[model samples]
Target chain A: MEEVKAKMPRYYLAWAKDDAIRKKGANGGFVTATLVSALETDFIDVALVVKKKSVYEGIPVLTNDPEEIKECSGSLHCVPLNLTKYVVEYAAKKRIGLPTKPCDARGIIEQAKRRQVSLENVYMVGLNCGATLHPLRMREIAAYYGLDPDSVVREEIKEGKIFLVSDEEGKEKEKWMKIDELEEKGYGRRDACKSCVTKIPTMADLACGNWGSNDEKKTFVEVLTDKGETLFKNAVDSGYVAIEEAPGKGIETRQRIDAGMQKRAASWKEKMDALKALSRSERFEFYVGALKNCIHCGACKEVCPVCACEEDAKCTGLYDERDSYAISMYNLVRIFHLMDSCIHCGQCEDVCPVDIPLTLIQRRFSERMQRHLGYTPGMDVTKKPPLYETELGWSAEAE
Target chain B: MAEEEWEPKILAFCCNWCSYAGADAAGLERRQVPPTIRVIRVMCSGRIDPAFVLMGLLEGADAVLVTGCHIGDCHYVNANYKTRNRYEFLKEFVDELGLEPERLWLSWISASEGSLFAEMVREVTEKIKKIGPSPLRREWKK
Candidate 1:
């Protein structure tokens, strides 16, 4: 904490694997204390993240998990866990704060250039992310394994398998398991992570990891940018964070991890290709099946980022108790409404109780949109969709 | 080949400023263009939405033609540019959807080119008549 204060005293976000923090049990009291320290100052305001639906159609606020703050005004927003909310919040607030995650940093950079989110106020604190699983799915998998879903430690992700540690009698036994390995045992993940391309977090000011050492005891935080370099240097000189060059075992361990990831990537390509081969009609049937399993929870649409409706009245009765056909027709229109805007983030699939491959359906359509229109959603904010605007002989390059 | 009926339902979406005027001029001059052509005059060729064009085919139009002003001479500036790129995009889209891309067409016409307008109508009408109504729509009936 002293080290962090001796430095720039800027908003800092840190990402560390659970085990690294668990060695001291209270995460050496760093993460919570950092939040507390930031809250104490009027200059720094911290926002904790909670993801819900666009049903309310406003800033990302989470009503579920409430936290106590000393001085910082913390509000949750019902936005996706991706960098879109971070960027939007930063643009709206016009203040300096730290964001953690590699893709979040990349998303911010891409959005910032389009004036969607400005990076001028962002302090990019990147964590080397192999992937973020849909949290509820993690809980489900843990339950299937007969482990306390909440207690199972998700240690590391390498390619096709996740490495987890479970404690029995104060001793830890590590288990390496694939998603399919889990599925065969009766649990599956949301579809979006199946096609994820980035293994290491990208373009972050600093990158931290848990996979770098055989000892696997320490958080491997690397400064990848000038801002990160300065902050770490200050933090270290002031004793806020302990700093060290990774041991040789750390490098060796990470190499094996990288090789494992490469092997997984090859197999992932085959699985994703098969997933993509499902016809549009077949995918639509999947949606129908999902809706049939509906308790009318309305959670899927609620979490959907581009589903522009607020209340049940706004939703046009897709799920009336008596009218099943109306629901099917309503689902079709909803699919079209978000057909162009969906990023295939799989957040909706995660939120669905029926375990519908909602993300896969979106992926199928988004793939078609790209094939048909050469438009990849979320890549560029400037490209006006061919469907939305009047047809004129406009330059593909809008200059 | 002649045993199969060549009844072309050619949908010509013409811009009001130029192509529509050209079609009117062709009619006034009594040019011998095929009567199979159905001319729908829009505010601008550029004003035609791709969904409308796609829906026209889905509704069983044998051929769809989008006619607008020549480059740099749009009724509204750069409307033709949108028309061109959008048509090209739809062409690709049709190909990907396994529909015949040739069934869709784009051409440039002016208010004064009565002869040219007659020739375009005659040629497109002939091609569509030979190709017949979309098999995709025929399959949809079952």
Candidate 2:
């Protein structure tokens, strides 16, 4: 079998019989072919995929054209964009398909719980994501290694190594660094990515990844929902992809890989929880110290994937700049609102101009609250989060 | 330091059908309520958004009281259930923000429970006094 470039259709752990697509895509171009097939067959009216501008940059493009979908094949490890709000804002009523990282899939499901978007019309092809690089950090890593950051053509992080592959026309330079060494040097995946445990997007319709497969050119796809099955059959019937049954060992391998990634992330989470070492007043001081630098721009709230608030949100509406509170009403109300529904996606921290460690802060506040309530946001829409829950599921006296 | 003694400034939000009428009843019965509390009346306890409690804290109120009719006795029927739900969030949030848990409270005071309202105010004022001025308070000397 040669590189399978998108051409014809077939169904788990299968590669495109066409060599052109299989060679170009990270795995088997199954995701690209599926989206293309979905569009061509009118299964979905639109497909949203990130178009990579560079190793450090990608932008989400909403398109209905199969050729456009085919062109945006390979993934960019540095573009940590969440597509949940985009769907709510742009395609709430349309039949839509999009590739998702775990956070993106979780964010979308959170929006669905809030009734911002209807999950019935959305098809999520969840990509197995170990982690993503911060764009600025990637540039820094490139420059730190004596390479022009702009000249870098491809960046791959695999097996704990950061590989910088630079191609200027026909001239190519490839270098690799241990992720642990880079992290020691304060460069690598974003803190949220380091701490994130959602390696497999079980919340999505179909979970696709290279985790379990021994074949380097094929993808291991798990049909998680009925919608996933519909999508798989649609792509196969439309002749845009061909898949084979995954080998038995592949499933066990995937589980082992997931467990390993989770353990690593758990350690990172433990390491990053700064409040654990602080006294009660010191903890308060630490939070106030970090949050006081806020110019109250509301950028964090704006980019929050799970936040469904608009211009007149509770956070902004009651906040007075002149208030001399130890903490601003904006941060207070925002944190309060997120208590039950924060999916811990880290978009708020990503977009914060002041560089507040919001992922840590949000996780600190929400983790305890969610643990107490026995509620996990974004997993099941039927389970209303504790904030909105009318009856206290647990006794109030339990506190 | 000015050597002037500090007093707790409590901000209480009372629902109109129950707690607000109860506060009025307290006045009618000449109950000795603490002068520390400044009562704000709303038609329903559910009408008090969490922002209001946070705003009170930010406004230098040592304690913010959220009082409504008893659960299942809401004028709107089941609205106080929502209030209780929100109070749970407010309680966790206040604690997490590093404020003394005593600085925030939730209680049910019926329209006829004037003395209970007065007693609750006294209790809140005494507890807040023990905790000292709210850290969020802007010192007059400052």
Candidate 3:
């Protein structure tokens, strides 16, 4: 145990000291406690937390008050908002601490690379995620389970089962269903979450979750960087949290879980790619057919996490409504620009008004290009995107 | 009109420092170059943005050529290398978009290589003719 604690990147089982917070939080209250402690100590100027309006809704709230942070405890699995743009627009200059999922952390990292946000001012507490359900889908799921969607007050996922609790006429009822069985019936996670392989937020400062912890009231925490160590020390010294070294068996279990999730995600990706069977001309027809429905709303660009260009973007600037080409210049330029840097977050598809399946189209174009260049965006701050590289740094023969 | 009599309209972007002067030399030498190509001269090959090429294809050009100085011979001290780097991205994009690979061409020509300029135009014209008109072309209503 001492040897494990002595390592640079340490692992531990941690929980909150306060019983109220522990009871309210989904996994222990370690994340909530740490953020509260950081704010109380003035370590961060503000903390960005997801405030749950209900089981189906969460809004990003930026605050310095520790009381508000405590109130925002617990997890909301149906909220799929990416908080990168909010950080850039609202708290880019402040010392901000926030709990991040893998996609949110990756988006922030990519923004840092583009000079949109300073990495030094941001502290991330990462959460391990298997998947998130769309809010509408969750409602449909409630209906399918023979419960009034509005009556459902609580939801929990554990042991490969989805548990829903409903209140009616001063009585409580509970029901559970297997996630695999639900997904097979065409109703589980969002399309993006089903294929995403990054189940753990390894790119963030500290990663916290319940994957490896033996107790339901404790969180398995991994201090991934120097900043993570600082956050952990502050939480422990402030007396808001308690910790114990993670058992070796717990570490093995965590690794096994991550590997299993990644394997399942890869298989899902293969199954979801419908364009793989099409010929060149048919693929062209499919793209034109899908993209023609775009109303030029630009919602996808607004929600895109990797795109740093705010106004006066080339895609919109060069596109003219009069052209009426087979494929609009807007879609063409946007796809071309993101070839090297797209993180495939699926935020675009979520916001697209026409339901054009932008996620599948962007993935088809960008994934092959990224693989050819041997580049993965948002992974590192120093490795510049290959698209911006000069010929001297990037050889033409590399193709 | 017969298929053999159909002429493909080609758009060629020539850099002022090298390829543009090479085209001038071809005219001076009275070389038998194809009249199918329409020349658009820019200050440097690096100035030719990928957007320009994409716009050309969307505008119904049967083929587009990107002509620049040879490697290490760029008049702007490696700007043409940037053009080469961008060309790779354009190549992959065009191919994936279901366009024939033959529709796009990239070549290096010096000011003295007038014969090379004429030969490239003839070869490009021949290939475009064989492939027929691009599907992106907009036919005017009678």
Q: If both were scored by lDDT, which would come out higher, candidate 1 or candidate 2?
A: 2
For every model shown, the clashing-pair count is 22, 15, 0
Estimate the TM-score for candidate 1: 0.63
- For model 1, how many clashes? 22
lDDT of 3 at A262: 95
In the range A1-399, model 3's lDDT, one tens digit per residue, is 446447644889999998999988888899999999999998999999999999889999999999999999999888889999999999999999999998999899989988999989999999998888888889899899988888889988887788998887768889898988999999988888988888899989889999999999999999987788888899999999999989998899999999998998899899999999998878878887898899999888888888888998989998998987888888898999899888888889888888999878888888899888888888787887777777526566411
Q: What level of docking quality does candidate 1 show? A: incorrect
Give one digit per residue, the lDDT tens place, for model 2 in A162-214. Answer: 88988667788888999989888888888899988889999899899889987
- C-alpha DockQ for predicted model 3: 0.52
Ranking by TM-score: 3, 2, 1
A1-399 per-residue lDDT for model 1 (tens digits):
446445543222232222333253112323322333333432234434333222112233321121332111211111225644534643435544443554466555545544555555555655544555555566566566566654554344555576666665676666667866875554554346556544455466665555573333345555565655654554444444544556666667655775676566457645655445656445334444655565656676665544434465334453345543412434444454455556566667767777766666666545566555655544443564444555533344311
Point out where model 2 deviates above 4 Å.
Answer: A1-11, A168-171, A322-324, A397-399
Give per-residue lDDT, candidate 1, residue A214: 33
**C-alpha TM-score for every candidate:** 0.63, 0.94, 0.95
DockQ of 1: 0.19
Q: Which wins on DockQ, candidate 2 or candidate 3? A: 2
